[model samples]
Target: MSERKKQHFINSVMSYITLSLATIIGITLISIFISFWVTELADKDAQAINLSGSMRMQTYYIGLVLERENVEAAQQAIEKLQNTWNSPLFAQQHALLQEPKQQHNLLTRHFGIAYTNWLHHTKPILMAMAKGQHKRSEIEFLLENQVLLTDALVTQFQNDAERKIVNLRTFQLLVLLITVSVGSLVFYLLKNRIERPLSQLTETAEKIGAGDFSQRVDVGGTDELTLLANTFNRMSESIANSYSKLEERVDERTRALKQHNIVLDFLFQTARNILESPNGQFDFQTTVENLSKVLGDHKLELCLFTERGEKPYLQLVSHNKAFAHCEQTNCSECRNQDSSMQALLLSRKTGFPITIGERHFGIIDLQLNNEQELPEWQHALVQSVANQFAIALSMSEQKDKENRFVMLSERTVIARELHDSLAQALSYLQIQVTRLQKSHDKQKYELQQPIIDELREGLSSAYRQLRELLTTFRLKMDEGGLQAALENTVAQLRERSNISIQLDYKLKNVPLAASEEIHLLQIVREAGQNAIHHSKGRNVLIELIQTSDNKVQLAVEDDGIGIPQTPEKFNHYGLAIMNERSRNLGGAIEVQPRSGGGTRISFTFMPSITRQPIA
Candidate 1:
């Protein structure tokens, strides 16, 4: 036999509930209909009993009227009795009691005999009494019998109503028993089929949550719970497989991470060794030695070309010299060597170029042993080391170029200084000497003395200016930088003269280049000296501030006799020097009368750091 398929748990529960409800409803409706029918029958039976008693009273009335010879009254009473006997209520009751299957029952047979006796014998006797014929004995006997029969029928109807009520009560008790049985069956289905499976599922889920991936649900049935159990078992199996492999995966990741850390440390140590030297220099030999330690038995060589030559001019080798292929007297000869020999040498070695951008400086070569090849990671490490060498070489070369540029600029400054100060002083002295000679030759005694006095004054002025130029040349900025240099210049000037000189330096955050600082210091000194000698000022203020447009402004203001419109008339060579220095600094110098009765020498220029480079 084929196995019967089990219904879904929900569908089974619904069907049971629906059937129980329908049965209860059917029983309730039947009970209500029977109650109504029994009530109506009882009412009819009551009416029948009331009529029988009334007929019996009518029978007594007929007998009384017949004895008095009152034929009309007796006839009226006989007609009423006949109408009541043949009424629809009595007829229906008669038909109901005459059941074919229960004809032998005592109550049914008694009712039938009483109805037949009244219709045949008792009714005919009443009709004769209504016609005034006194058949005394027959009338009396039959009327009494009719009264007895009606009494007996009334008792039977009362008994029948009582029996119907008992049957209704019995059917209600049976329905209540059926309801209780259905309810118990429903509870059994819930506990065994639905609740038990849910409890097992909850326990399995708790175990899974506690990290026991091997736990699974085992519910069985062709229902939703069965499908859920199968899916849960598969999920647990998959999780168990993954958990078993987790340690291997973690170990693999750990090894890869350790290797990465080692590579990072190696790169860091290599960079530190290459940049360890002072003054922007690199210690390539120390870096190469470190690389040899890491490479172990492998032979490593660094071959470098000259700045303007194709031949290798320098070679640095590791401790192991097992693979020294270059044995030529001159490295240039290797370039012209036999091609087959060169190919053979190249095949035995691996090389990474040491270059940055388009500039090639050198190459690093490594020779492997027989039947050995470099791993990818080791090949990448060698390439990275070569790149580090290129970066270090590039930085060193840039520092050298910057040093040469600074030297050339300083030389230019020195030449400009000599021309502006000493050369001009010598020319003036020579012109004075020529004037003295002409006066002496003309024999002009008065002109000769004044000319000699003028010559002595010119020589004294030249010597003083020469000493100032030497002081300017020897100026060096200390750690305090431009601010400190200005402060020192102000103090020296204050000591030399009884002038109140104040320095208002506002450029605390500005970064000045070496050339910018030198030119600025020289301009300030020249301007301050001019103020002391020619302006005859009581107070001088030197202000160094930055302007709103990012230009640096230096102002030397003095409350003195101010500057003349034509400063050259007073032989102000210092003004020319200040102007020259300003031009060299790429700025403009303005010597104008101050608004407050003094001279203000303002030099405005862009700071070197803020200036854009010329393309």
Candidate 2:
């Protein structure tokens, strides 16, 4: 049966059971109530009968006395008793009570016959006695008949009461048996239907809580509780499937991260080499040329274009023979040129300014070789790279400025030292020489001149030391700034890997403060290396952009293998680095698997260490 239909059936069945039980119970209670009422009525009727019989006996005793006033009172009491016996009250009382059967049929018949005879024979005699006109023998015979009738009626009343008591006791025992049987049945039904299932549900819950997803609920029938158990089972299965897939993804990401680490080491070595190279001169043309060669062989054209206002100019173009030449001036030339161009144009128009610490930089563009064939992951990579480049460029420039400032501050300190020591000593020595010359005592002049010469030599030495300090300070401040570090990193990535790469020649706001820019550069280098080695992606995109909230956004996207899906693998070193860098800059990292197949990592850093103000 369908789940919902089964649920309805269960509900209907439970309802029927409940209603049936309630009806039975109601009837039982009502029957007991009726029995008690009848018993009470029987007790009252028996008392009334006994009292009436006593009154009749008393009237007969009065007749035996033959006193005038006493006989009248006795007759009045007998009349009252007869009236009560024939009343509706007595009839109603008798109807509620069960009349007992006579033990001896013959004796009962005889009693009735004798009662009738006595009533006929004694009435005339009683009238004579009341009028003082009865013969003595007739009065005696009437009295004897009255006594016989009274004895028979009294015997019948006693037997009737005794029989009713026995019947009541038998009825009470029957009711007690019915009640106990019903109660036991109800208890059994409750335990089977409710308590047992509830216990099973509790056990299942405990198992799931203890991380045993393998446990399945054993449910029968279509009851609500059974349906609840089914839902629990489905949920457990779904969770297990999801975690299994997640674990697989985690394993994949781990493998990719290991490869990325290797690439980073290679990039590191390349960067060190470039930094140690002569006169800050590196082979940029060779790097781009090699990238172009590789893409050319792959039949995938790699073109670097500069977007100026509404116009785009191609800086470097590499295409296979199948590729067509298009005008770089009009964006429409690439309107149908490639999907990457579309994405690039979209990012350019909508992209916010990129900032790193106090520095803000310009936008970036990405165009693909295949215009018609754009994969979802590829699109994601484009967006991720553009954003990463925007942020990295801004931060890279800022780092340059800070490094310069630090170097300048260091030189300034040395300058202050020179003024405090060498210059002051020179002034003191000059004053001592002037005094010695003015006094002109030959021996004093000789001694003071030697001391003055020694002081002069010390002053010359101090001046030389100051000159050296200033020179060293100037050299350190002037050479190898934050921009130099970033350039070295980019050059190394291109040289070490076969991936095609290009940095916009005129990334606006080229200079940045020291710390923020360097961190941004590091973010870019790390992400780039990861993409190149781990993602196994052919192309890399690094972007530096700014957002509306006066913050810098850095994104790095690659067509590389995507991030791990498992929670355990989700906390990998690459992710950790990305997260740490973002946190250190008071930002957050968003890592999403590319729509088609890849990973996109992006982070946003506000200019100041405070939350963005509400709009």
Best by TM-score: 1
* Cα lDDT listed for each candidate: 0.75, 0.56
Q: Which TM-score value belongs to model 1? A: 0.72
Model 2 C-alpha lDDT per residue in residues 286-385, reported as the tens digit of each score: 3333333422322222233332333333233334232333234443434332346545555443222222343323322333444444444434433343
Per-residue lDDT of candidate 1, residues 1-615 (tens digit): 133234555445456666767776776787678777767657676676677667678778778877787878777877877787778877764676656845545556656777778778776777776674546667777778887887787677667767767876787787678767766776776786578878988898899889898887887766666767788889888888988799689898898788768777888987886677566566666667766555555667777775656467767777746245553244433332234434554454476667899777777777765648876776788889989988888878887898899779778777776776667777877887888788778877678777678778877887888877777777889989999998988887788788899999999878998778888898999888888888887999999998888889999999999888787655456777678789988887898899988899899998878876777
Worst 10 residues of 2 by lDDT: 294-303
Residue 58 error for model 1, in Å?
9.7
Error of 2 at 22 (Å): 0.7
TM-score of each: 0.72, 0.42
**Clashes per model (N, Cα, C within 3 A):** 0, 27
